[model samples]
Target: MSSRASAPTPPPSSPDTGALPMVQPAPSGSSPQGLALGLSAYVIWGLVLPLYVTALAPAGAVEIVVVRIGFSLLFCLVLLAVLRRLGELREALRTPSRWGATALASGLIAVNWLLYALSVVSGNVLQASLGYFMNPLVNVLLGVLLLGERLRRAQWAAVTLAAVAVLGMTVALGAVPWLSLGLAFSFGLYGLVKKRLPTPGHPVTGMTAETLVLTPVFVVGTVLLHGAGQLTTLTEGAGHFWLMAASGVLTAGPLILFSAAARHLSLTTLGLMQYVAPLGQFLVAVLVLGEHMAPARWAGFALIWASLALFTLDQARQARLRRRARRALTGSQAHA
Candidate 1:
């Protein structure tokens, strides 16, 4: 919920691929717990971020991001120790290729967090929602362009509709929605690189490694910001200081929750839950934040929502077909 909205990597197949593969369902033993944790994480991300924007007032986005990175690394280190996973971190460090990959991923995620913080600080939470809403579609394009994945007709139509929506938004705002686009693309690419990394299931270790890579820069930058009178956490009194310090938990808690959820939920269920964050952001922007949405902007949002409907339906249909096929094959082989 810290606006470091994490996207799990896209499947090797485009989500819009005509023949979507079956995603395994959650194990019964853990489904309830996973659903609870995942929902909590998503809700915090979507709803709590706006509040943090207010709390982080007087602190520029860059300073907040620096604190977030520094404290998150500390939190991750603690979790690693408690979980007895320091060996995983050591193993990752020993591999030179992983070092490079994690370094790159660190930069990408930091960029993502910075951009998201900037949008929120600028009172553009509505745009942030739009960006996340466009994220899955962006992943489709990334898969096609980067991974040589093919998109079916439905997928193409969805992308086209999204384009039209972007055009509408541009007209409504008298400029392009760069903040939205930046968030979508940055997070999309982050997920892509993280997927290719050697780290498999150790989210804590992987994140710790990435943050460790960024720690020095953030540490030095914080000092420079303080010297320049740009940093505000200390002068802001105990209340503000604690809130700033809480960035560690704000940044790391949801990730741990998400990792727990991933182990016990189907990709489909998780996909559905993914929208909760954006939807909450959208509501907060309009209702609580009082960001006005002109008719044109509303029309654009409606179109994007429609496009998502088509995309989700296509994915569901393909998954069902794959499941039936697998069942039939299994039955025939059993008889044989």
Candidate 2:
């Protein structure tokens, strides 16, 4: 449902927002609650997010992002209060090391949100969907280069094919799809930074900290725009004003559900579930938005999907082996 940015194949400690920390297998008696949570979260992210952004007609991307950050902070604070996690937030603020990390993450996530909102408003939802589809693989590459993680041969092939797909699309479009690249790399990097941070505490608290760092920018931008009469929410109507104000809940709600779902689902199931968002996005772009999908773009999507299939299969295989090994160890210990 979310990336907050996806973790590498093992399903990061969390889906993207918080560190779920304990990823179980799909077969541990799947819960209806998990399924519902995962589906709801993804649907909101995939279907609702685009529609929401598109509905904010004539609002510039910067304006929307600014509003989103401000509201998201408010939403997180409220949730933290309800959850009694304000202490966690205070702890994060007290730590200087976390400030820099959260700041970088805030910047990356801001860029991701800005580009995503822009893509939807501009009817470039296809590019946005493709960018997210490309993100996990991008994380793979980041892991290899930045985290010194080794990838299996299949993983390498997947990464290479992803590059080829992007190259093919660029050749076909006759220009680099900067929007897609911008979304992919920025979110990928955000996940990378979040992975390095201390995860023993609440994830929403971490997100709240990042948004706190970003609040000043939004505050200033809001003031400047309002002073210049460029902020249009007041003129828009009560409904529009409420929608803008609801940005925080929209941002954090799915994430909270996702973290709950993580408690019930396996890494494999959650991994598969994550696809719902982009697929929803892709469908919305084609069916509702009526965005053009040329033959080359289709071909590019085909390549990316094929690469993802290979990558997913490889991860599944590795997970199976790991499970078997643990089972064997347990059996031997029993004999002893």
- Model 2 is weakest, by summed lDDT over 10 consecutive residues, at 13-22
Q: Give Cα-based local distance difference scores for all models.
A: 0.77, 0.79
In model 1, the runs with Cα more than 4 Å from the true position are 1-30
- lDDT for model 1 comes to 0.77
Tens digit per residue, CA lDDT, model 2, 249-319 = 88888887777887888777887787788888999999999999999999999999999899889888877
Each prediction's TM-score versus the true structure? 0.90, 0.92
Measured by TM-score, the strongest candidate is 2
lDDT by residue (tens digit), candidate 1, 233-295: 888899888898888787777766676676787767777777888898999999998999998
Residue pairs clashing, model 1: 1-45
Task: Name model 2 segments beyond 4 Å from true.
Answer: 1-29
